[model samples]
Target: MTLTTSGPSSSSAPVAEEDGRRVRRRRHSRYLLAPFVFTVGTAVLFGLFFLWPGVLGLSYSLTDFRGWGDLEFVGLANYLELFQDSEFYQSLGRTFVYAVFSVPVGYVLALAMAVALTSKGARGKTPARIIFFMPWLVSPIIAGVIWRWMFGESFGFVNYIIQLLGGEAVPWASNADLSLFVAVLASAWGGAAFNMLLFIAAISNVPQSYYEAAELDGANGWERFWYITLPSIAPTSVLVILLSSLGSMKEFAMIQALNGGGPGTQNRLVVQYIYETGFERSLVGYAAAASMVLLVILMVIAIIQLRISKRNNAW
Candidate 1:
């Protein structure tokens, strides 16, 4: 009788343990299911939109293909042509110039605006921020149009004001020298708002205690800002600079709408040149090659920026 009771108890204990394991496994499966689905969905989207198109573009770059039809492999002919193209080089140089002229100037302006607007003594901060940020909300094409109107030679508001002040009507878009300058100025005007907001947020997050401590140490406003404020927002500044540089590098819509790379290609950025090549001239393969070159340059810049950010622990 004792032996029989012991056997039943041992068997029951084994069954209970098996049931507990089954329940745990079921719970783990439920927890993993949602993440697995999400991961698969994200991978599929990335492949469809970005990875697949990039691979196809790379393959097409090595060919003599127009937009469509039979493809013939040309084996670096397009790259060779690109290397010999003076217009392409000129456009690339112009893009670099725009990035250089606009990005830093825009960053400084944004930082200044952020500091001014965030100060405790500032009046109508919200309205000021909204007005400053309005240009960014407008479409690039529209902004270009607005600027084009403002900078018009004969009947423009700028010319009207100049006439009032007895200054000459500056030919902003028509003049080759000033056209590039105008384009860069418009880009900076529109772009500064985004960086301003970023700086405002970053500046706001800096602890008030730091400023108070600096004050206690007999630090002047300039010294406090140079040491504590600048160092605190260094990471945000780097991020803003990187993004602004990238945007400036690929400037197209505003340039297109403002000058259309006109005054004899004076304002032509690389993207606009590529667009005209690929769509207008029906030189898809050549454009693709140029695009690949630009892409590589951008990738290198991005890698360098990432390395800098990592070194600074900005991630």
Candidate 2:
């Protein structure tokens, strides 16, 4: 009777173990279901909003689809025309110039502001940061309008000041170079605040011990910042530069509002050219081709920046 009871107990123990295993499997599936559902929803939305539009744009680039009417296949004619278009080339060149000027200036200005705000002896840091960051909160169009008001060639505040100072009134609107410079300056001013915030966060994360050690070793403020702080925040710097560069390259609205791409289209950047060509001129296919080129350029820039960031992280 004892042997019979022990056998039954052993069989019952295995059956209980199998039931527990089944319960765990069900629990695991339940846990995974939410994430799976979320992923599927995200994929569907991405396909609907991004991938579909991208595909249509690519197809449109190969045809003469003028926003409406039947699509006429042109077999790369738009691209060919894009390559030859003088206005396109001018806009592309101007865009590059604007990016080159604005990105570096904005980066340096942001880094400086961040460092200043975070310095040990800094006064009124909260108020100063708020003031610095306020520019970023202003709408781009409003910012542009304000700058235009100040920098208008005739009867502008800047010119008024110049006259008071016994200097010649500068032609900010009529001169292409001056207009581009103003745009670059405006871009840097508006963008620096956000980058400054990023830098502040990055700077705060740096271990305090490093700076203390540098100080003990008789390092000056600049020396410590150069040797320790800069290297520590390399990743953030790369991110700032990448973002600023991309933004500058894609700049449109503010510049359009400021000068209307004026001085007779001299400062018209690539995006403005695309807008004018697509919507204004109703050459949608041609504009799509240019857009594709700009997209490729932006992708290349991002890839390069990401590679640099990875290399910095490895170091």
| CA lDDT scores, all candidates in order | 0.89, 0.94
TM-score (C-alpha, index-matched) for candidate 1: 0.87
Best model per lDDT: 2
1-315 per-residue lDDT for model 2 (tens digits): 355345678779989999999999999999999899999999999999999998888999999988899999999899988999999999999999999999999999999999999998999999999999999999999989999999998878999999999999999999999999999999999999999999999999999999999999999998999999999999899999999989999999899889989899999999999999999999999899999999999999999999988987887
Highest-scoring model, TM-score? 2
lDDT for each residue of candidate 1 in 148-260, tens digit (9 for 90 to 100): 88887877788899989998888876887688888878998999998999999999999999999999999988898899888999989989988988888888999899889
lDDT of 1: 0.89
For candidate 1, give the lDDT of residue 106.
Answer: 92
Error of 1 at 84 (Å): 0.8
TM-score of each model, in listed order: 0.87, 0.89
C-alpha RMSD of candidate 1: 4.3
Backbone clashes, each candidate: 0, 0
